[model samples]
Target: MAADMAREVKLWNDKREREMYDNFADLFAIIRTMEKLEKAYVRDVISSKDYEPECTKLIAQFKTLTTSLKDTVPSVERFMETYKMDCPAAVNRLLVSGIPATVEHRASSSDVGTAAAVAECVQHFITSMDSLKLNMLAVDQLYPALSDLLSALNRVPQLPPDFEGKVKGREWISRLRNMGASEELTEQQARQLLFDLDSSYNAFINSLPKSA
Candidate 1:
């Protein structure tokens, strides 16, 4: 059954599904590392013995992603190498000897002023965005096949326990202390203010993921 499943995987696989799975793997890795290090600093951070089971599941999913990447990446690279479909001559023609060349030549100090540079830059920026949008639209039509290959390319390093709150929290506390309040706030007043602020910020952050 495992061999049958491995042989059935294809280059035209559903990229979005694989991407979502890869994202799960990434988050799991981060959570696993983060929790492990946190426990080292403040012992007994996660009291759950079930964490081992979660690790087992994460490894199984990761193996599936790794197998898919091994099959797909080389095939995609081969496609790009075979036909040069990625950077076609037509796209290059935009810069090779035409409007692009004129713009490049116009960058000479004698030919263009600061204001003209700004204008040209704005025009180029607009052109670039337009081209990018069109390119993505075409790519969306093609099969959304960017996944599985770059599934695990970039791994964000986990925070070490000692550096977690020690570095950033200390810096922020110093900045807050340096602000020099009119008088030292009483414990009750500070607690009330902090509670209110936390409530407000939590609400704000909660709204962000959906609205952002």
Candidate 2:
């Protein structure tokens, strides 16, 4: 029975990873779409050299998240064969209560969940960035769902070509073949920063006190 439960847990974990595998990817897409949404925020919130540093960092960071989503998400199907929604409260509780201490600071900012929700939006953006930094932490604690997904892939006899490499050690990803094409992925390039900055602006608007 315990062995069965363990399989259940593994399946549950795999299911969530599978979900995030896509979610993380989808979030990256939203991040890209944010460019369209955050234009004004970038113009206002980030200014001069002050924003430049963050510009460089955000681009790099978003790229990392994008790559993770692209590569790790599909591994879900490659890993386990089921979605485990059997007991979701345990996982949901963690999402509600389990943001890291560092993130708690960001989430609780005098800025978040207010106004045009700029603070909240920035807070969520930052928190999502943190989640990426944390390897998108899983379960109620720090179980490496990503690593587990990798292990599970070993069982698939004919893994997809994309699934066969190690992502941890890669520092450079190039579109060498498409490099000669028209333009960049748009989502992966610097424009995405503009979107996040714009979100900040909207958040700033949303964050404004209502009594005014």
Candidate 3:
């Protein structure tokens, strides 16, 4: 009976962890979507009135979800320490949560799921950069997400050759460094920044192979 109860508890804990992981994934997706919407608005693809309310709503939702995840971190950490599963999903969570896992956390062709997560994170960061204002404050806010995305990318052992070409980490790192320059940019400089970021990101996205 004690063994059975322990099994049940473990099952419940696993389920909770999976749910939280899903929540984390959803939050990234929401943030990227918000970034894209803002890009659309700035590009005049959407009206200001339409963009404002929707962006505001999404920001509120993001805050709430962020708070919930923060509250749950302790349990998640405990599970990670206890389980020590070196699988791709665990690696994904470690990356998303900014927790450093063992150096063995690498994605091979076999670890397609983790590779996809890493890819998604890279794509999301690139997308978000399009909406950045090319200002110090906006750029500062961007660094943490960029760091996280890079950390995730570093964990991939070997990406499929074609997929790798699509997510050029060096180009991204250089673009980020360019944006990080502290001097105030002129209107022309700002426009150039936007153009560069959008062009690089779009080309990366377009280069991705179609799903099987």
Candidate 2 local Cα displacement, residue 208, angstroms: 36
Q: How far is 32's C-alpha from truth in model 1 (Å)?
A: 45
Runs in model 2 with CA error above 4 Å? 1-26, 29-38, 41-45, 72-212
What is the per-residue lDDT of model 2 for residues 62-96, given as tens digits with 9 covering 90 to 100?
A: 43354455555454222222442232322221223
What number of clashing residue pairs does each candidate have, in the order they appear?
A: 0, 19, 0
TM-score of each model, paired residue for residue: 0.20, 0.24, 0.34
Q: For this target, which candidate reaches the highest TM-score against the unseen true structure? A: 3
Report the Cα lDDT for candidate 3.
0.48
When sorted by TM-score, best at the front, the candidate numbers are 3, 2, 1
- Candidate 1 residue 152 C-alpha distance from true site, Å: 35
lDDT of 2 at 75: 41
Which residue pairs show backbone clashes in model 3?
none
Where model 3 places Cα greater than 4 Å from the true spot, the runs are: 1-109, 117-119, 130-139, 146-185
| lDDT values, one for every candidate | 0.33, 0.35, 0.48
Instruction: List, residue by residue over 138-211, the lDDT tens digit for candidate 3.
Output: 44444454555555545544444344433554554555577754434456745655565456445544544543
Stretches off by above 4 angstroms in model 1 are 1-11, 15-80, 85-99, 107-109, 113-116, 123-212
For candidate 1, write residues 46-114 as lDDT tens digits. Answer: 333343223323333333333244544434235335544443322232223212222334566553443
